[model samples]
Target chain A: MDAIVVSRLTKHYGAALAVSDISFSVPAGSTLGLLGGNGAGKTTTIAMLLGLLLPTSGSIRILGHDMARDRFAALARMNFSSPYVALPHRLSVTENLRVYAHLYDVPNTERRIRELADELDLHELLDRPAGELSAGQKTRVALAKSLINRPDVLLLDEPTASLDPDTGDMVRGWLERYRAATGCTFLLASHNMAEVERLCSDVLMLKRGAIVDRGTPGELLDRYQRDGLEEVFLDIARDRRPEMVP
Target chain B: MRPALRRVWGMVYRHLALYRRSWPRLLELAYWPTFQMLIWGFTASFFAQRLGNGGAAGVGVAAMGMLLSGVLLWEVALRTQMGLAVGFLEEIWSRNLGHVFVSPLRPWELVAALIVMSVLRMLGGVLPAVLLAWALYAFDLFAPGPVVVLFIANLMVMGWSVSLGVVSLILRHGAGAEALAWTVLFGLTPFSAVFYPVAVLPAYLRPVAWALPSSHVFEGMRAVIGPDAIGPDAIGPGAILWHELAWATGLNLAWLAAACLLFAGQFKAARTRGALLSIGE
Candidate 1:
């Protein structure tokens, strides 16, 4: 069964259309990449999926529960993380994680915290306030928080945006390992084409609040007659029609 | 523990942990209430001595007690409102509302956690003032007897109602409306009859003052602590106390229900506007 299923999703901010009617599904345990430039409705779509923003019209089902009527049930098995949203600055990493663990009702909380601490390399930062951490450190802590529940589905917005190349690669590797170990479904929205190509089994390209093109990364590269997703992304973003293959 | 209560506690613990590590944050909770108590306590003493010089020592003592009680009880309402408003603001400032609302935590569960935190913060801030009023002024806020509990409880409910209104405003208008959190109750103070009886207001304003549950509470405080209660044997708070208490309770219930409705509507509006995720920004 699909971990997430969105049907006829649309959102309007006053008279302005933010997300037009769009529909897609992510099967359980698969990673799907959502690519768009700013204001392409990626954030709005993600927000609607998380039930943070009510769609003007449409329905969302996550893990077999309707978001409108039974969001809390699905929310218990899902988690979201974004660089734009932060944990409390004054809280220590451990305090933040513990609070989320409790919020998620994770049993054996301390042991789970210790395990995440080890995996996220948060030992040195556990006692330090979140506001004091460097950007890369904060990203790792945010990741740890998102995983505190051992969610079946994770929605990540720019999961590795601020990291240096080495740290970014390391986080990507950790995410790869995490998925391998847990079979967690991922819905990732990011500007990094390389990250999407490396991780996403399927890709959805959004423009002006509508899905413009979608396929596997290799298929997109071939269809656009490009060497990489970046070139394909540029073509789509610039509204260049893909070359016809006869 | 039940999962729902555990979630509420987790939210409460998040705020408590902030105070646990930060002495400044802890101290801030008590500072204003203590300072307000000191200032008002001394002012009440001066007026009492003036009344004593006029051959009304008995009335003077009673007035002093009532004034001090007014100051302390008013602080209860102020602190409770601030506690709840500031707790909600903390989530917005941290940009944590997105994370919070996305979890299994329901809107009502968040409200429950906030109510608990408000009471805890109220105690942290007001207990110090209560202790100082007793230690320095020999003013027992509890002198009005068991009815004092009812008085404080009524004020707390009123505070929560006002805070809900303020939070709803913040939700609808975003951070630009945050000043209402601190200043809204103060705007109601004159109309609340905190330092005086509703009778003292001009005829047109008396009805406005009487509309506030807090006015009834303060009026009730005066009735229980009036000059007739000079001796221990004369310390019976009569039917007037119960009459005022009933009015306060009924009004508080009405106000609380209205505030809750307003908050629910605003919360829905916030979700529609996508304000919850971007409020602080």
Candidate 2:
């Protein structure tokens, strides 16, 4: 079964439709890129998938568990990362990690936390308050928090944002290795086309709360005659031919 | 044996971390309570003088109660609302509201943490207020021992019951509703009989005060401390014990059960409305 199965999932804020009749699925152990404009509803769809927002209509089955009615059962095996949601600012990195560790009920939490700190180059940051960290460091900490439970399904929103190029590449490399090792599914919402090209197996391009096109990175490039994912992103944003909603 | 302590330890560590960042903000939370107490201490002591309850003895009693119960109940009330207000506000400001709630931690666990921290804060706040009431106003500070301890327990129960509704209102209507909490809370005070005997309340208002947990708190506290401060003349021992204990025991049990239900319902409602994460990072 797919790791995340969404169908006719719609969300409305008053008369405005944030995500309207959207549908997609990520096969277990695969990565899917969610692309959209400033208000194309990528975040809303993600919120629904995470059970943060109840859908105005339709259904979502994530990791074989119903998100609407049985979110906790599925949430046990899932985790998410985003810079926007920060850990307590005054909390040190280790303390922040401990909160999630307890919440996730991770076995050998101290050991797991140590492993993440070493893997993410966060050893020196363990004692620093979370708000004291630089933006890039915060990104890595957020990633560590997401992985604290060693989830089977990882939902990341701009997981590598604001990192040095070297660090960003290292993060991507680590994510790839982790996915390879655990076969965990990743649903990443990102603006980094190069990162998208590097990590995502398939792309689902969204426009105004609906999918305009979806295919493998290579397929989209070949079909649009674009040199890279960035070109394809631009074309979609411009509503150009090859990715035109029609 | 070890595990429960470990869980409690973990909960303490987490709040300690949060306090590290929020210490400055918390100073802001304290400002209002301090000001509120100063006004009560200064103004109510004025009234304490005119009532013949105004002798140096009366001034001392009034000042002591203002310092003691004022700081005590106010601290309890402040801490509970702070937990709800700041906790919910923390979720909203962090933009991680979705991430935190989506994890295995239920909302009650979150609320419980806030209450636990609030309790600690209440204890911390009381120490200084008591000393100041003595140094500044020559108030008789009777040592409470176990009686004061029971009063602390009642303070938490009553404080949180009211705060749950306050927090729930904030979650549902957004922080704009926060202004209403104080106005509502203040209006409750006169009816609560926090300053005087509930019997003194008008015939109609007497029942209102009877229904309040604070009425019990003031009554209970008076029983314990009044004897030391006023000797046998202040109020009957049996009547004081019955009234105070009745409010503490009877009201706490009823309010606790009702508060738990309301808290759970608020949790479910906040989740459905996407307000849980709205309170988190």
Candidate 3:
């Protein structure tokens, strides 16, 4: 079954269409990369899927539960992450994770916490408050938080936007392994073409609230006759739509 | 229900840790309220003692009545204001509101965490303010009796009432609502019957005062400590305490329910139309 089914989702902010009618689905255990520049309605789409933003029209079925009416069912099995938001700065990394651990009612809390800490290299920072951590450390903590519950549906926004290359590569590697082990589904929104190319099995390029193009990384590269995903993104951002080739 | 409350407790723990870590800034935040209470309490108590009836401790219970209830009303206003300002707005400063909401935490859990933290602030500051008063005039800090319980309940409801109103305003606007919250409070203070008795209010404004839950707080507190005691009768052992207790309990419940409804509507508006997240995001 598809892990996420967004059917013609539209979000209107007064007269401005933040996310025009758009539709897509993510198969369980697969990854879909949502690539867009600023104001491309990327966050809006992610928010709607998370039930953080209500759609003006259409429906969202996440994990086979209707988001509009039965969001709790989906939310219970789902989680999201973004570096822009943070865990309480004053709480130690352990404290922050403990809160979420209790929140999800994760059984055998200590074990799960230890596992995530070891996996995320957070043991050294466990005693430090989350606010005191550097940007890279914060990203790791957030990643640990997102994985705390072993979520079935994981939606991430710019997961590695500001990370140093090494740290970013490590996080990407961990996500890949985590998904492989759990067969978890993922919807990643990022501007990092390499990350998208490395991780996403499919790509959806958005422009001004609409899906301007979509394909696998190689397919998109071939269709745009471009050397890399970066050139393809530039072509789309500069209003250079690729011609369809049958 | 237990799970939900546990979540709130977890949030409280985190909040306490944050406050401890940021003790410097937190102390600064407490500075204004601490000073406000002492200055206002001393000045009000002085006027009640001299220019009015009995000077300082010599004044009749009428003076005690005004001063006691004034302190209680300020407690309510300060909690409600800071819950919105200090507690909720802290999320904005830390840029953690989005993370909080996206977690397993619900809206009520966050609200409870804010209110409880606000109450703890009272625990830290209220005694010191009362002690300062006790030092000057030698009034017992604990002399307020069961009325003190009523005062705390009153403050909780008032916090809920004002926080809901302010949260609603935040949903429609953004940080602009901060100035508006204080502005609304300043506009409503005189109308709140916080200083003088509600009887002194103008005929038309009487309805306005009656509408505000804080007015009832002052009335209820004064009923216990005033010259007439429980009623037109005398102090009569614990009779005054019982009467004040009944009114505070009943009115606190009403204010709580109303506050819940107000926040419910605000949450609904927030869910749709991009209200929960700040505007222009």
Tens digit per residue, CA lDDT, model 1, A39-122 = 999999999999999999999999999999999999999998898899999999999998998899999999998999888888
Q: Give the interface RMSD of each candidate.
A: 0.7, 3.2, 1.9
Q: Which candidate comes out best when scored by DockQ?
A: 1
lDDT (Cα, tens digit) per residue for candidate 2, span B177-215:
766555555667777656566767889888878777777
User: Model 3 chain B — which ten-residue stretch has the worst lDDT?
Assistant: B230-239
Ranking by lDDT: 1, 3, 2
- Evaluated at residue A34, the lDDT of candidate 3 is 96
Candidate 3: global Cα-lDDT?
A: 0.75
Report clash pairs, candidate 3.
Answer: B49-B55, B54-B59
The residue-by-residue lDDT of candidate 3 on A69-96, one tens digit each, is 8886787788888887778877788888
Worst 10 residues of 2 chain A by lDDT: A237-246
Please provide, for model 3 over B1-281, each residue's C-alpha lDDT reduced to its tens digit, 9 standing for 90 to 100: 37687778767776777777777756755565557666666776666657455333424445654665476457556645565446776676566666666666778878888778777765565556656656765655346575666566666667666666776677667656766555665677786666767778889888887766677766655655544432344443323545444655576677668767877787777778655555324
lDDT of 2 at B159: 72
Predicted complex 1: DockQ: 0.88
What TM-score would you report for chain A in candidate 3? 0.97
lDDT of 2 by residue, A40-143 (tens): 88877777788877788999998888887899788878999988777777778898898777777777988999999989999999999888999999999999
- Residue B104, candidate 3: Cα error in Å is 2.6
